[model samples]
Target: MHMDEYELEREASAPIDMLETYYRALGWEYERSGEDEIVSTFQGSWTQYELRSIWRAEDQVLQFLALPDIRVATEKRDAIYETIGLINEQLWLGHFELWSASGLVLFRHAALLEGEDGATLSLQQAETLVEAAIEECERFYPVFQFVLWADKTPQEAIAAALIETQGEA
Candidate 1:
């Protein structure tokens, strides 16, 4: 079930199409780089990110990735490695990691729609996963910055990032 053939089934738009439509409604620009993949950009307060998604129909998996422009300096890889454990502990959905080969740090999450009795992927599901990934990336962006640029210890970075919050009274 390749993405190209998935759209031909039932004469209706496929899951990938719905996913693209979801992004369109959010007013984000995207490009389909392959039959199963799309790339989009999102702007956060700290920086902009290139977000890529790949729909794997055979596996019934939709994977989303958000990559910031900064690279983990060769010397700083150890620091990021130490910090990721703490960051991942607090994350509910996805985890951040350094792509060792490229020295790139990226946030990744996936939605698995397999084996749920006749369940089909929907726009809502795609939007929910994507929104969560974006939010997760933004929330933890500062932690990476703390380690990569500010030379904060992993413990210090996590403690600072995990401070309790209060709502407006």
Candidate 2:
């Protein structure tokens, strides 16, 4: 199924409790890891999808963007392309990596490293990758639900519902 169509379907059919169950079944191991970074894995008949959360610290932004080594600076172009190439290689291998550097405000799909130093990417590019990954996972897994709890925040659940609906449209 196409990604937009899947988003619409997900938005329409996913229920809150179901999403909760999906998260819960992963167990404490997953949740513990999520504290630092969220990681989710799904296995279908033919493919496996692994979602990893990427984080960057505030001080690291300049260094990350400039493609600088911890101690010294070098030609930015060379570093950027090299980084992008490595990331592209990983994507071809079917790994979905999401980067959240400088708080949750900036989200992007790490598409490719541009130079020798790895310059991270912007959110739009990241979303493109994420959409593809989600679609692939849904093809085989099929089942989805919104997992909500009384004590938990409603925002994530709401987002999940919307995502499900968006899948169908």
Candidate 3:
């Protein structure tokens, strides 16, 4: 998909359409609910992720969220929050957050549409944004799991997630 194909016709519409095309090219399952919102699914090695791309015309920003299949119980929120903080510090592109209301751990990022001439959005940028979200989420998924189920401390979970290993070497 090219920028011209995904160029915002009105600052509000068309971006989502471009996103739809992009996801389609990748053979990912997706549903476009509206001109500004899209829901997609990605099956990763660790888990299935629910991906969302929302375009806010008023703010001229695009929000991307990749949610792995994990939930934080009420008793686990404190530890999960701490782990998220540590994980976020290690991140350069997007950040992980706990959606308190839903108790869902999700990776979120926002891209600012830098111009007024109907925002030139390229597929490459979109892919980078989406990839960052999913990669970060997959990278630290075990951190959340260790804290919630294995009862590991935040520091320990972060350390486990960061350990370098040559598996099967």
- Local distance difference test, per candidate? 0.75, 0.32, 0.81
Prediction RMSDs, each to the true structure: 5.7, 20.0, 4.0
- Candidate 2 structure quality by residue, lDDT tens digits, 30-124: 22232124444545343444445433332222111111111112323233233333334434424312122311111123333343343443333
Looking at model 1, report the run of 10 residues with the lowest lDDT sum: 160-169
lDDT accuracy of residue 163 in candidate 1: 62
Badly placed stretches (over 4 Å) of model 2 are 1-29, 59-108, 111-130, 136-169
Indicate the residue-level lDDT of 162 in model 2: 47
Better of 1 and 2 by lDDT: 1
In TM-score terms, which candidate is top? 3
Off by more than 4 A, model 3:
1-13, 164-169
RMSD of candidate 1 to the truth, in angstroms, is 5.7
lDDT of 3 by residue, 1-169 (tens): 2444445333242567767877877888898887889999998868999999899988888899899988888999988888888888889998888898999999998988866568646677767888888778777887788898899999998777667322313
Using TM-score, rank the candidates from best to worst: 3, 1, 2
